[model samples]
Target: MAVMTETEPPPPPPIRGRTLYRLRVLRHDPTALLGLVLVVVLAYLVVAPLVAVLSDAFRLQYGDEAHAGQAPGEWTGYYLWRVFRSPVSRLLFWEPLLNTLVVAAGTTLFALVLGGGMAWLVTRTDVPGRRWLAGALVVPYMLPSWTFSLAWLSLFKNERAGGQVGFLEAQGVRTPDWLAYGALPIIVTLGLHYYPFVLLLVGNALRRIDAQLEDSARILGAPRRTVVRRIVVPLMLPALSSAVLLVIGRVLGTFGTPYVLGLPADYRVLSTGLFQSIRDRSTGVASVLATVIVIIGVLVVFMDMRLMREHRRFVTVGGKGAMDRLGRLRRLRRPAFALALLVFVVSVLVPVLTLLLSTITRTPLDLSTFTLDYWLAERLPGAVGFPHGVLRGHELWEAAWNSLRVVGLASVVCAVAGLLVGYVVVRGTAPRVAGFLRQVSFLPYLVPGIAFAAASLSLFAVARGPVPALYGTTFLLILVMAVTHLPYSSRSGIAAMTQLGREPEEAAQVAGASWWQRMRRIIFPIQKGALVTGIVLPFVSGLKELSIVVMLATTGTQLLTTLSIGLVDYGYTQLANAVVLMIALLSFTMTTLTQRLTRTSLASGIGG
Candidate 1:
């Protein structure tokens, strides 16, 4: 009997049994399954491309074989040496790096001064038309950043580029190089575009401050400047720092403004330098620059988070009955109003009108040279490639349609995927998987659009494993845009889902409803408004998105933005201005409609 007992032991559990058990568990718990799927997809879509970019920076690229004496795809340190240690590194990296730092610092300072001051006027002081100014000040943000640059050139361009002089130059007023095309114009234009960040963040912060704090300081015989320094500034440091980081981050990666204004003067920042490398097929060099840009962006984001945490340690405690009255301007009210109006004119109305004027007149602001030819004519001299008026041409319509189709589809994709991501993040039983999914989904927000595009071009441009090469395809554009803009929708989704209880989905599950059925019939119906907001935000953003598509779009998939920039490159300024106006018109109309529907303008945060 003892010998028989040793003859047989329990059979080992089959591998198939374990796998089937996991499948069954996954089937029952859709959130866990979804989280797993999302982690994989986001890793491939978001993380893989970044890895590819980083890898490329250390590898020998195709055209660098001769220079590096290594085969393409082999690991090499030549790119690093070329970018940071070579003789031409000054032009290739150092100068651009220095220029980027200067521009970022200058733009941050300018935006903070302008935006923080305006925010104080609107939120703290009794400024005239505060409501209207609050809304109007953010208009430049909605327009593409380069819209200001184009308008700047229309008004201030010198003979630097040689083809077409600006309005001042046309009038025999030769604009200076510094004011026309270098860091000054770039800084000012980008500042005007980004100041809204400060307005929204600082304005909201200003509102949250108890007016009694300032009044208390003033009543204690503290001078106005002393009161501001001791009380108001300390309370608002978090927001000011946030705005500074936001402005700096944007300036770091913005391409259109710098490219349009900088190329003529050989003024290159990291963005334009990366662009030049990409255009010249210097993939290794572009990868190095892009990596540097991305690292800077990540640092900025980390700094923002750390600063917010540090600032919280010195929180201002306000009483329940805190008075929030607007500061009386007395006799300065009218002048303050005029100053805000003048800013609006310079930032919003002037750029828009300048572009409109350019489109109408053969020369800017010249009424006698006015002609409808730019918009309505079928043919005009010197309009070489784009022969017809923008309104009359199929090119404009086609590009508009492409923008709508690609961006529209991408927005819908983002909304759905974002909701799924939220579901997984909020309900998944696996904490690790859920946390990974959440973090991965938000990674694209840290990577700049241009750098992301370059990464996408590097990773997806060629076939990998079973995936086919995706370079120059509309699908690639849609994919890149959806990933780049996912943060807006994902944040919207998470916020909406956080307020919703799991009871509805649970009840549906008890009724034998499947996961997809519950999502479609219960979750989606309940979160329709959030979903719409998600779609509208991304759609509006993508409509004006230039940096992402500029690198990904092909001739067949030209968006309104690319088409406009192309005209600019071709020396067709009026034609380009016409397209820029169309983009602004569409963007403004959509934002206005959204406001009408939701009782919430995009700038409502600042206004409140």
Candidate 2:
């Protein structure tokens, strides 16, 4: 009775002002506000450009009113009819569609075979120099996809496209159309560039595979091949599926590879067809084709979703005494080692050497002739359009500087925003908002870069809502690049954040720390590696980007990619090769520096 009389009421709930309440809510459950903001912003960025593209499909577009026989801005089915039912439908859509499927399929097959085999050899076998091969194989990925095509053309391109004959053709060996300009070259070039995607994904999975499972199967008298066919193959399906999807998506929209390789043979895929339509001022046709490509890309992604759902029932991540078991190559060891070495030489070494030789030679592939003009001459005696050497003036340096500035700003902002978006998606209280933010962030990856560029140009060329007109501005370039490359940073952020425990933040909260304080002191320090990864991947990729920037760059805003492409357009082959080499060198240098600074790796950072 005395205790009851003396007992005070339960402590009152803490009183908070509106600002403090808001801050507390943000610190505790940011989903309702911060997550919503990210979702809305990301959705707008991804969906607006798409809407801009699709809207052009239904309405009579500018410069197409005459062709559509309708007033501009009027809604009509003319574009749909022309693409699906008109007389040239087969030529305009069907053939290219068929060709697109063929290229995508071929490229996927090539990448899977080469990449999968290399992954096994490097990760699951005691191959000689496994460390070197592993690093060497990934080098090709750092270079632009078009670099392979350019190198291929330098060695295999005949006189079909005019200008100078390729090395072989110059040596009086006539390269057939099939080998030099069409599907074969396109497939090979793309495969060389994209196989690293497979290697990284599959090898990461392979390294994590449990040796106990295979050992048990072997002890049960299961043959080696049978164990692999059953246990290994099933375990690898998820990685294989992802690698296939990535390759297909890239092949579907890759402009430079197909454009460089397919032009001479009239081998047009959907991407090249889209480019042709836009170049020809057929905006209606371009929209129709672009929409179809996006549809295909979506279907591929959906199929992957279904596969992932099915794969979840089978777990491979954890098991007692699980460890990587390298296969005993035994008699096949050296042959396997040789095979891996050959791939490294062909995929990484050959193309780079070819580009170097091209840059030094007035007559490429001719060992007897060499000139330093492309690298350092003040003037060229017989040069036509670009009458000066590549290093003759500030043009090259200016382009490099612009590239560094634009890409640097974009990557830095992208990395920071990615971290915030990741925080919201993972730790926020709003499930719906989190999910939307997560998906929208990855949306740009499936969309073709050129189609994305077209959409951005259409949408941002004029002011809308809070954003002013961004066309013709360097900031626009930075924004386009950032959005286009958001998948890298966001994915990195989300992966890193998922592994981080909330205990640190909760501890900070218990200590009366604010949200920003927690993020700065705990989250940022732990995720420094991932932040560097996000920044570096985008910077490396952005340095070599051609398609997205081609449509967006204005006069006097030449980036390195645009500079190289300009030289190519003017038939400055040697100079173009020099610029390409410079791009590769810059990419390699930055990658190396970043690794030293952060002590991370391409394989680990990329996969994990």
Candidate 3:
């Protein structure tokens, strides 16, 4: 036996050719095959559309007539040259680019200062009402981004914008034009909306940090400042980087805030620029803008990845219950906690309350002239015009109905695909396939919503393969929304399935249960909570979404959010406000329901 082992078993039967070798490897690990299928399918669905946009950017098109001195399908640098070097490029590209950078940078700075300060106060000090503040902080993020923009406009729109007087004017305050629109309002609105991201990320890290490190430094005769600067700050860098990256990524791609604010002042950020280019039939220029945005996105994502990798090396695990407690500021604690509470109230509650108030008001800024007519009045005469009362009108009801139908369809598609991808990634044995699937599934998260919509428009405006023309159909909106939101639901599914161990499935299999039977009886039951969350979140997101569907939607297929955009375009601020409020309510209710469902499931899982 020893001699036979030394002979190396005759070279293991001379390993087979490439195809057979792949088959053998797959036979040993079926998970890889599943992952490969997922990756290829997702690439076609997600990556192919992006490629189409890139290809579109280099092609020249003429306006129906004689080709205009340029070949129809010829590759040209006209778009790039015009966008980057032409005289109008400053107005079209550079100014907006600078504005985008300024807004993103300012938003990041404000969010970090506000969120980090609050996180430190709550996690380090014994702040009063920390629990309430923590809960309230995230509410702004849950609301639609445009909700804040519209609320701000309602509270501050001056005479310059041609809208009715705002709340400030009603209160004997002359609001400045700068405050009502442009980069200032956008920065403030976006900052307030996204600060919660920083809070959650930084606060969680703060909570998990071991207290002993700070204490050890203190015991070594280090001062509080020294300990903070040398010990705490170093540890917090990774979290800060992550928060900044996330906030920047979000702000860069944001369309609603910029659209609501920027369009009024001709403040064209990349997203708005792309939207304008597309609307004006400048597809080549729009594609270039989309590419630019995608490049920025990819760069930011790379930075985030690098930071996360670096964070892994700094991990500290130790004994239980090691948390540092900062000495209270005593009398200052109440004031500090109150200020934090005030910020939450102003950012989350006040804006939402203002929206509710504006919805009931007959005129945009006249708070005293309250009326349920906006909510109840059905089909006012055309003379009422722009903000005409159509609350209970057939069109309004139809848009709402369409919104529910599209969002419901999208949610189902996303949930099912996300769960399948998640299951394959978590339980499958193929490392190569799993890694590929995971990366491609997350590609949409790196893409701006407007860019994605533009890509979809470019791809599906004409038929390809089994998929027919989807340009004006409700199905296009559903597909775009579903794919754009896949990352969230897929990530949620992965996390949920990972938490659920394999023992149940293994036991089912041992009892002679088939794969589908095991999935139905054992796996699905355990993961139902996550599945609901996955579905509900996308439903809510799709309900309030503006950027992704703005390009693809037509009059016949308009969702409520898109309808709100149309109302805005027609200068119907009050009616737009009403529509926005309805969308916000729907989103808020869905989010609350999902959170409750998630919590109940988590609790049940823990108890069982």
Root mean square deviation (Cα) for candidate 3: 4.9
Candidate 2 overall lDDT versus native = 0.83
Residue 159, model 1, lDDT: 86
**Residues 71-152 of candidate 1: C-alpha lDDT, one tens digit per residue:** 9889999999999999999999999999999999999999999998899898878887888999999888889889999999
Poorest 10 consecutive residues by lDDT, candidate 1:
1-10
Report the C-alpha displacement of residue 398, candidate 3, in angstroms: 2.3
Superposition-based RMSD of candidate 2 using all C-alpha atoms, in angstroms: 4.5
Give the top-scoring candidate (lDDT). Answer: 1
lDDT on C-alpha atoms for all candidate structures: 0.88, 0.83, 0.81
Per-residue CA lDDT of model 2 for 8-31, tens digit only, reads 788755665667877867666554
- Cα deviation of 603, candidate 3, in Å: 16
- Candidate 2 runs further than 4 Å off: 1-33, 215-220, 316-323, 465-467, 495-526, 604-608
Question: In model 1, which regions exceed 4 Å deviation?
Answer: 1-25, 319-323, 605-608
Decide which is better by lDDT, 1 or 2.
1
Residue 118, candidate 2: Cα error in Å is 1.8
